[model samples]
Target chain A: MIDEIVAAPGAGRALLDDYLARYAPGARARGMVLEQVLVAPPVWLDDQSNTLTIRWSLANAGAWWGMRAVSGADSAVAAWWAEVDARAISRRRSFATAPEAIVRLCDV
Target chain B: MFRLTQLVTLADRAARDDLAAALRAVGRRARSLLVEPTLEGSFNGGDLLVHASFNAAGDRAAFELEAQALLGRPATASIDSVSYSSEADGREPGLRDGIYRVLLLSIEPGTDRDTVARFEAELLAMPRHIAAIRNWRLSRVEQAAGARAWTHVWEQEFADAGGLLDAYMLHPYHWAHIDRWFDPECPERIVDARLCHSFCRVDRSAISSGG
Candidate 1:
C-alpha cells in the first residue's frame, strides 16, 4: 500500500511551477529572487482527530523579497492558492482517514 | 552542547515503527553518549521523529552517521547548533521534558538587520512574560546553504501540549511582539513542528515549580 502511494505522481512540482510562472517575474521585477521552493508529502496526524497536514517551505534571495507571491496586486497566485485550499477542504470532508489515501497525497 | 532532531516520512506504517524501535534500542545501549534520546512516531501518523543531544559536536555527527546507516537512506534532518542557551546560566534548566515546539524560520530579504536583532531579542525574553515556558533556546543554523536550511531555530519545552496550545500559542505578547515577522506579508518563512517526549538526563527535582 505504501509502495503504491510513494510511486504515485506528485502535484507539488506542477503547482510550484504554476506559482513561479505566474509570480516569479513580478518578484524579480521587485528585485527579489525566489531561491528555492519545497513541498513535502501530506502527513496524517495520529492525534485521533484525523488531521492531515502538508508543509511548504520557501526561500528567497533576501529578507525583503518574501511574500510577493501571495500578496500585493497580483491575484493569480492567490487565486491558485484558493483553489488548492478548496481542494484540501473537500478532501478533508470526504477523506475516509485511510492511511493509503493520505500517503498518496503526501507523495512529494 | 549540540542537538540533532531529524524528521522523516517513511513509506508505510511498519517501516516507520521499525525505525523507531531500532532507535530506541540504540539509545538504550548508548545512554552515556546521548542525552535524552528519543524516537517516536510524530503525531502525524506516517513520520518518525528522532531527537538526541550530545555534549560534543563529534558525537553528534557520529550519531547522525549511525542513524543514516540504520535507516539505509539519507533522512531529512535538521541539526541545530546551540548559539544561546539559558541553561548555561548555572540554574537547573526547567525544560527537560514534556512537549517541545520547534520553529524553523528564514528571514525576509531586505529587512533591516537591526529589526531582525530586535525581534530576536524579544523572542529570547519571552520566558520573562510567559510563565509556562520551561526551557527555551534560540539558535542559528550553522549551515544555511541547502534547500532544507532555515536561518534560525526557536525551541521551547512546555509542561504539556496544553502549555503550547492554550498559553504560548494564544498569548497576546507573542502576537504583538513576534508574530508579525512571520506574517504572509512579511519577509520570513517558517516551518514549525511539535514533539512530545521526555529528556532522560534532566533532574526533574531540580526544576523550579515557579515559571
Candidate 2:
C-alpha cells in the first residue's frame, strides 16, 4: 500500500514526524510493516512543503485481514487519521501488487 | 409507525455480548426489537444490530435516552442509525424461529435516477436468486434521520442464521454478480462500502410488522 500526503506549505516534515510518532506504532502493532518513507523534492526551503509518502505492507492476505480487523476495532486509528486530514492538504492510500501476484491474491 | 435500525460499534470488544443481552431485555420499550451481533460482510457492521419498531416517533425519542446508557458513550465507539416509515410487500409473516438479517446502505451521492432505480430493482430481486430468504422487506428511507442518511433498508428472514452466513453470501448471483454494486473498487459500484450488514436470532417475523 502507498500513502501519499500533500502537506501544507512547510508542514511535510512535521506531518511525517507526527505520523511516525503517533500512527506508526499502532499500525505496526496491527501487523503492518513500514516499508519506506520519502519526501518529494528531498529538500525544502522557506515556504516550501514536501509531499510525504509512506509505504506499508503486510506479509500475506491473512496478515492483511488480521491488520484490518485489529485496526477496525480501534477507534484511535480513525481519530488519528481525522487529525492527519487537517494537517495535510490531501491524502490518498493506494494498494497494489505485482502482476505475478495478481492471480494468487485473487485466491482470497 | 416508525422503524429504527442501528448498528453500534463498541469501544470495548468485551462489551458486545453484554450489550446484546441488555438490548434483548429492552423489548418492552419498543413494539418489536431484534438485536444481535453481525456475522460478517462489512467492517461497519458494528458489535450490535438494534432493529426496532415504535408506535410513535416520540416513543423512540423517549427510549433513545435509556438507549444512551445501554448503547451510548463509554461503551460505544460509534453508532449509525435510521428512522423511517417502512414499505413492505404484503406477505404473511408466518410464525417460526428464524434469522433476521438487515442490510442498510447509502447509494453514493450524485448518481443518476435511472442507475439508482436499476440498482434498487436488482437488490429487490435477490429472493428470486436465493430461495432461503423466507420473508423479505425492502424500503427506501422515508426519513433520512440517521447518523448517515441510508438510502435503503433490505431485510430478510431466513430459516436459520447459517443460511444467511452461507447461502446468501456464497450464492453466485450475490458474490459474482450483485456484489459489483457494493464493491468499492469495482467500476459498477453504487452503494457506499460502509454498509450495515447484520443479523440476529428472532423467533418471529420482523418484516411484516415494522411497516
Candidate 3:
C-alpha cells in the first residue's frame, strides 16, 4: 500500500494542480472532495476542521513546539494555500505558525 | 563542552512510524548509542509523539547536564532550528509541523570557539546530517510558497542549480543574532555545517523515541 502511494509521484502533485485550476477562477465551490484526495491519505486527517497539527516536546525540555495547516472545503486545498501566500504577501493575513511557510508550496 | 540537536522530516506518517518502530524494536543495544523516549503517540493533528533518553557515554557529560535541566542550551549547543511542512489533515487552515527533538548538553570547563569548530567539522562530515537538513529545508521551502515558487526560489536555487544558498540560509528573524555565532574565517560554511549536524541528532532521537 505504501509502495503504491509512493510510486505515484505526480498523482499528489496533479491533484493539487487540478484543485488550483478549478478554484482559481473564483469557483467558490466545495473543496472538501479535493481536500480529501490531496491531503487525506498522506496526512492523518482531523475531520472537524480539515486541519492538521504536529506537536512535540523538546528533548528533556518543558516547552512544546507545534505547526498547523488548515483549508476550506469549498476551495481547492491548493487554492487555499495559494490564497494564504497571497494574503501573507498582501499583508491581509499573517502566519501565526511556522509550518505554513513550507505548506504553501504544495500548490507549486 | 557543547551539544547539538538534529531533526529529519519523514516523507510520510507511516514512514515516520516505521522508522520509529524499527528503532525501538532494536531495543537496549540501540539505546546504548543514543538517547530516546519510551512512550509514543501520533496526534490527530498529524505529528508523532516520542519520549526517550539519550544514550549514556563517557564524554556525554554535556548532554547529561542539560538533560537534568530539560532545557535546550543556547548558541553552543542549541545550534540549529529549522521547520518542515507536511500534508495537512485537511480540516484546518495551517500546515502540520514535524519536529525532531535533539537536546545538546554542555559540560566541563565550558565551550570555546575552537572546540565548537572541531565539533562542527565532525558533525557536518556525517552523511546522515546532510540528508536530514536537505529534506527538511526542501519541505520548509515548499510550505512557504507554492511548489513552483519554492522550486524557482529555494529548491532550484539550492538543490537544483547548486547555488550559494545550497549550504546555508539564515532564518529571517535570526539573521541578526546568527551573526554573533562564529569567528570571521568562514561563518556561512561553519554555521550551515553545524546546524545540519545538530538537526540530524534531533531527527535521530525522534526516530529512536518511536520505537
Per-residue C-alpha lDDT of model 1 across residues B97-189, encoded as one tens digit per residue? 465555555665565778778878888877776767777667665543223345675666667666665566545455334554553322231
For model 2 chain B, give the 10-residue run with minimal summed lDDT. Answer: B180-189
TM-score of model 1 (CA atoms) = 0.50
Per-residue lDDT tens digits for candidate 3, residues B24-100, read: 44333323233232113211111222222233332334433333243222211221121222211111112123233
Interface RMSD of each: 14.7, 7.8, 18.0
Candidate numbers, best TM-score first, in rank order: 2, 1, 3
At residue B141, what lDDT does model 1 achieve?
58
Chain B only, TM-score of each candidate: 0.67, 0.83, 0.24
Q: Provide the overall lDDT of each model, using Cα atoms, as 2-decimal numbers.
A: 0.44, 0.74, 0.26
TM-score versus the correct structure, for each prediction = 0.50, 0.60, 0.20
DockQ for every model comes to 0.03, 0.03, 0.01
Give per-residue CA lDDT, model 2, range B1-211, as digits (tens).
7787888888997988888888777667688777777665544677787888889888776666567679777888888777777556534477368777778889889999999899888877888777777788787876544446789888888888766766676554565467667643234667865667777767677776662
In model 2, state the lDDT of residue A91.
75
